[model samples]
Target: MELMNGVFRPYADSFVIFFIDDILVYSRTEGDHVRHLRIVLQRFREEKLYIKFSKCEFWLNSVAFLGHVVSNEGIRVDPAKIVAVRGWMRPISPTKILSSMGLVGYYRRFVQSLSTIAAPLTRLTRQGVDFRESDGMIAFIEARLSLVKQIRSEAGFVCPRRAS
Candidate 1:
């Protein structure tokens, strides 16, 4: 892709860019790592490229690049996504409520007792009720968000034995 080539061609031998902007600089030795970083930084300056320092990580053996968290530990969902899940809010429309529930349900495996956890909210959906930020709704939202924060993994599928 032009975007990738434009941003990363200069660092090809020593590093690989993941997800377009997530750069993973690799080196065979510590000295090489330092040199590679310097070279890359220099190229960035030359290209007039700017990076968010807060999002930049260095000297990491493993890291979360893109959606999957990469590290020596292996790949998993990014913690920030987990945080986003944990802070999910109840949608205000029937369609949006269903959509939100569906999205979260897709990752149900990451949330323990998902069925039970979502029982209250699900009931409202079944009854064709519009979403509201009522106390119970708020509680359900908080619970789902907390569950998502606690677990960061792809959800398993739960097939409906009988179609509606």
Candidate 2:
């Protein structure tokens, strides 16, 4: 926590630090944000805590922090998490397939018709077939990749309607 405090002290006026690891720098004005960032970076240097510059995002209307993606709009699944879903691959061994299935199944709710889409692959597992990419696998891969962009957007979850 000491490290976080040192990294955050300079930007105290403009931003609120959350959960030590997650930093939410707020700005009442665009100019404030710029200034706040500079101060924050300096504090980081003083603290000797280096941020992964490549992963550091700035001036984003929304950003994925921790497991949840945050934006000016709202919170949702992290884009990095979605990329994992999109890049999912069929497993070669029975154990491997089951493990992969478990991981993918966790996010099944986010993917539409997940069972229907994965039916063929699931059947292969039940029948104890060796891992081999088939037409069904190829189709599934293509279908899931196609849905990546849409799923990351508004289609993620069903929002409740306002009561009249």
Candidate 3:
């Protein structure tokens, strides 16, 4: 990957970027797009690397990569992943709680206060810490549920409103 990065270093952010096996090319004009693809293909030829053509896409207005729907507008949650999030049950054990956090942690940037909010549950993971939800942990769960509900509504998740 470092070698690939070295090859693409000049075009980073402006035209193309690579991640392990994926490459995304962005251009503002058809002419520029053609030029960018040429440059990338040339680099690939030199590096003796090849892409599986069957998985490639071109002339795309938007693309989904690694759980995000990327487009000119902005990134948004993948509806499929949202479905999984919505289906998640309240975690009962320390292991389950950690697992849930691991799943959700990918979106940590969207949840600015996550560390503070998850402090209680995180403490339960520490050595000699009782594997029980303390008062703070309960509050964290409540806050998490509220946040998930808001995200669901934003993503057009339709359901009967609960009585608060």
Candidate 4:
């Protein structure tokens, strides 16, 4: 991954984002996109790395990278990834609680003060903490409900921009 970074260091963030073997080149215009794609491909050629044509997609208005979708509207958690939360059963153990937290934590940036919102659930995970039905169930339900509300709003990690 570090090697990938060095290979595209000059263009990182401006037009390209590379993770391991995946390279996503983005641009606001068709002409600029072509230029950006050329630069990225040229780098691959120079470095003797090969990209499989079958796995490549071009000229898309939106693309899924990692777990989120990047598009003109800004990044959002992929709906498919969150569908499981809709039917999630109440967690019964510390491990289950942690798993629930992990799911929400993945999109923590979209939910403000998630740590505070999930405090009770977090406490249930700590050693020597008694996992009472009242306390744990209330916290778990609250956290899950909060996440569902946020999902309904279609919120996720949207980068802030300064006023022009």
Best by TM-score: 4
lDDT of 4: 0.82
**Where in model 1 is the C-alpha error above 4 Å?**
1-60, 63-66, 133-136, 152-164
State the TM-score for model 1. 0.45
C-alpha RMSD (angstroms) for model 3: 7.9
In angstroms, give how far residue 113 of model 2 lies from its true place.
1.7
lDDT of 1 by residue, 1-164 (tens): 57657767756734565455667776656897798888778877987889899988888876656555555434455567666665666556556556767766655655678777767666666555545647557757766765674464334222212222
Model 2, residue 19: C-alpha shift (Å): 11
Model 2 root-mean-square deviation: 7.2
Error (Å) of candidate 1 at residue 102 is 3.6
Each candidate's TM vs. the true structure? Answer: 0.45, 0.47, 0.72, 0.88
Model 3 steric clash total:
0
Cα miss at 109, model 1 (Å)?
3.0
Tell me how many clashing residue pairs each candidate has. 2, 1, 0, 0
Backbone clashes, candidate 2: 1
What TM-score does prediction 3 earn? Answer: 0.72
Model 3: per-residue Cα lDDT over 19-80, one tens digit each: 86778887767898999999999998998888788999988977886776666555565667
Clashing pairs in 3: none
Which tens-of-lDDT digit does each residue in 118-142 have in candidate 4?
Answer: 8988888888866666877887788
- Please give the CA lDDT of all the candidate structures: 0.63, 0.63, 0.69, 0.82
Q: 2 or 3: which has the higher lDDT? A: 3
Better of 2 and 4 by lDDT: 4
